[model samples]
Target: MVIRDFDEFCRDITDIYESTLPNGEGQVASYIPQLARVNPDQFAVSLCTVDGQRLSLGDSKVDFSVQSTCKPINYSLALQLHGEHIVHRHVGREPSGRGFNELTLNHDGRPHNPMINAGAIMCCSLLKREGEVNVADRFDLVMDTWRRLGGGTRVKFNNSVYLSERTTADRNFALGYFMREKQAFPTSTDLLETLEFYFQCCSIEVHAEQMAAVAATLANGGICPISGERVFETKTVQHCLSLMYSCGMYDYSGEFAFTIGLPAKSGVAGALMIVVPNVMGICTWSPRLDKLGNSVRGIEFCRRLVATFNFHYDTL
Candidate 1:
């Protein structure tokens, strides 16, 4: 059963956020014309425990595109479909030791890991359905996962954002072709269409409330608290979290793991999700990002969480 302490936890988080949500900060991601238009000052945070407790603050009802934060879910699905050996054939486990959008891969032509731009694209191909692997079907599964995770009855595409991704996706297009040349993505799928689907996956919208639940699934060892279902294998969650621990925050992974001390993921769309092992999931969303494209306020809140709670999965 959901406990009362979690409600107290929420109140503490809300109070902390209200006092310090970054009055002065950096800019939001504007590369994708649509995201550039979002209100930069908007911020939110949410938390959930394995026992089904929940807490939310600051624009809790607002939905935001998940962006690269979508990598872990799709990566888990890819691991389920293709298995580890085959999936590793296309992507590497080592952190790229470079920026996420470096437009390059490891010497072996594999994406350094499955969390960056190069690797996430590889996962999109890896997780695509067998017969046609179209966006509609792939997106339906993402929606299913969201419904199961978020407890929301409905989820839909942000068409304007999706189109903006398509229009400004030249860099990703180039990455796709480079991978294809390396035999990394040796398929007949059109690069634009595949990238379109990738963009749509990033565009899949959810509020901090649902994101807290999604993180709770990971914290609960893959069990959906609200849905009473298992969306991934236990081993898969471990692998996904391990990868997140090592590389999920894009360029900020090491610092994030050190400061926040949680297995976490961040979106260029200014969303953050952190998993606290058997305890709970914490999520923060704010459009303003530091140079690394991680949410500015999101990082500060996590810093406070780690410091105040003495939380750290590694320490556990």
Candidate 2:
């Protein structure tokens, strides 16, 4: 077993979860109406080991939009569809020190990385780019990929969130138009379709239990631990996790990588996915968000997790 004392580990995690409950700091994200309406106090932590052992606590079954957390998944799909050389040609692999929604590109004219809105929009254009598939078919393909990543768990689409995102997507629209103006997208790309696809990807809904399985797939080198399915190539996950470590937490990416020493991605919906490569994958959800948009309780759980266990990369 990857975790020697599984029972004891569960107890420790439970303690951390309980201790984080009293933290009333941070506000729930209000940019999207649907996100703003979610119960801010809802919190959950779920973990799955590479060997498939699982545990969930608090509001484990409650569904929440994946939001920006979908960036890493879509980025992995783009890498699998197109090799690193081609994918990096459109999106750089360095962290953008600006906000996640910043309107900026690298010196090479590509978005800094696929973990930000601009880069994620670029990735959306890459998926199903052959023009053979329609928008619905393309989104269906992404949903299928998400299900495989989560060990065949059901992945739902929240049309309300999707509509809300699209309704309030002036910034994303600006990014799309800016990329188009800069010729950053591939030839014959449909700008509106690409932006809508990006919104749909962000609107994917899964509870912490399912998200833990998704993280575990990445931790197990792109193989879904529960269903034993290969969802992505090992190399694809390697590149994806590298960028996640350096660019996933918006402007706080550097601090997170320095302190946590783990590959993690946080979404405005208060979803945080952490992968302990070759060991386990964890998902923490709490709608209360810090200024950087990370889940407040989720961050606390991670700090307590690494402090209690030798999971940090440096600990090796």
Compared with the true structure, all predictions reach lDDT values of 0.83, 0.92
TM-score of every candidate: 0.94, 0.99
Error of 2 at 117 (Å): 0.3
Write one digit per residue (lDDT tens) for candidate 2, span 1-316: 9988999989999999999999989999998789889988899999999999999999999999999999999999998888899888899988889999988888877899999999999999999756555788889989999899999978999999999999999999999988888899988899999999999999999999999999999999999999998999999999999999999989989998888889999999999999999999999999999988899998888888888888888894
lDDT of 1 by residue, 1-316 (tens): 5445656766777778986685559898989777888888898888888887777888877888888888999888889888888889889998777888888889898899989988988888876656765577777887887777665446666888888888888788889989988888746656666677798888888888888899999888888777768877898889999999999887888888777778899998889988988888878889998998888888888887777776776666
Clashing residue pairs for model 2: none
Positional deviation of 29 in candidate 2, in angstroms?
Answer: 0.8
Give the runs in model 2 whose Cα sits over 4 Å from its true position.
Answer: none
What's the lDDT for candidate 2?
0.92
What's model 1's lDDT at 246?
92
lDDT of 2 at 298: 85
| Best by the TM-score measure | 2
